[model samples]
Target: MANADDMLKVAAERTGELAAPGMSSRPSRKVAVLACMDVRLDLYAMLGIERGQAHILRNAGGLVTDDVIRSLSASQRLLGTEEVVVIMHEHCGMNGGSDDEFSEALAADGAHPSWRLGAFTDLDATLRAGLERLRTSPELSARDRIRGFVFDPETGSLRDVESD
Candidate 1:
């Protein structure tokens, strides 16, 4: 298990020097990727992107929500991002349950979230829905640049998903 002391060491090492300085303030790839906050998934390495290359937004399932829309709205309209890619994966934590049920369980465990959990019964549907959500959000500026994919956790492969 990770400890607070180890985290402080990591932070100290990180702040000691710039990992990849001299890159532009804007992402070099000019893209933003919405991905799940999976421990096994390395967003930059898996996508062949580097630090300062793309903006990555991560959450439980990488499901599009009002908060995501707010961040992306600024990423595009303010930060010069031109592309959006959503990456959902198999065997996700958000699968296999209803949001209401999950919330109830959380409440029992003494944790309560007022926000929507964005749970889904179908992975592919959720993936496509995230793409469409970004495309249709009136707050986002680059609607045409949005797309979605499903990642295979076992094989570390991403399959293109139809965002109809």
Candidate 2:
């Protein structure tokens, strides 16, 4: 199995290939996409985005955490990224069970004892919570646009939950 460093080296090589000469000239659409870290979801291909088009911020469940807000803030101020797309997908491990259930499972598996899963099972509720979190975050620019989406992993379809 490849170690973390090995995986990183492979990723760097792939990124370098995509960022070769003439690739830097492609205009970025100034979009920020918040997506899950699920290997099954490809943010670039799903959005029809080419190289250097948007800034992708991924986490466990695609929830709008403080770090995401901070990154989005920086992207808005420095990277010309003003539009945000928060994508949560179907069949997500994050949504498979309740927070308590997940926490218990983690403990049973000898994971971190302090692990407390964030509640994100309800699709609509999770989307709304994420949207509201971004909208109300002081770190975000006042003029920034935010949208929510639900990606179907099985069908490879994107459904807009709410547009800006």
Candidate 3:
């Protein structure tokens, strides 16, 4: 059996061959976006961006955690990314509950009653919270631009939450 490194090397060579020559030579556009891992949200299509146009960082609720800060810092300082876009969508699964409630639900068995309460919850508060976290993060340069938007899954419209 091939080792993990050998497998990775094979994959990397295959991916390099598939990449466009311009993408392989140039750094991506100077934008770093944080968005949810929701299947309904299509980042490139929605933002009208093509491949290699931006650096996308996705996670649950696109919450601004420590790893996000580290990545954002590197993107700005090392990769020439000067803009941050936070895209939170409506009908998110990570809304309408405290962190404790979420942790408790995760720890419970498959039949936890609280799990039902967690679905299709209002995501406005969480969206605002994520925006605020980005605004207050010291890792961002003062000149760096940060903006937040809420994508309505029903209407397929994006609403600006805040801008900096």
Error of 2 at 56 (Å): 0.5
Candidate 3 wrongly placed segments (more than 4 Å): 1-17, 22-27, 105-122, 142-144
User: Which candidate number has the best TM-score?
Assistant: 1
Q: How many collisions per candidate?
A: 0, 0, 0
Q: Tens digit of lDDT per residue, candidate 3, span 1-164?
A: 75999988888889866668645322367788899889999999899886666889998777777788888888777777788888888878776546656556666855544322333255666567766777788887633478789998899999887533
**Candidate 2 lowest-lDDT run of ten:** 18-27
Error of 3 at 52 (Å): 1.5
Cα lDDT tens digits for candidate 2, 1-164:
75999988888889856556755432388888899898999988898997778888898888887788888888887777778889998888788658887777887998876545666658768887899999888788744578899999899889888643
State which candidate has the highest lDDT. Answer: 1
Which sequence of candidate numbers ranks them by TM-score, best first?
1, 2, 3
Tens-digit per-residue lDDT, 49-82, candidate 1: 9878889999999889888899898988888998
> Which 10 successive residues of model 1 have the least lDDT summed?
16-25
Models ranked on lDDT: 1, 2, 3
C-alpha lDDT of candidate 1 relative to the true structure: 0.85
Query: Judged by TM-score relative to the true structure, which candidate is superior, 2 or 3?
Result: 2
Backbone clashes in model 1, listed as residue pairs = none
Clashes of 2: 0
- Model 2, runs deviating above 4 Å: 3-27, 101-116, 142-144
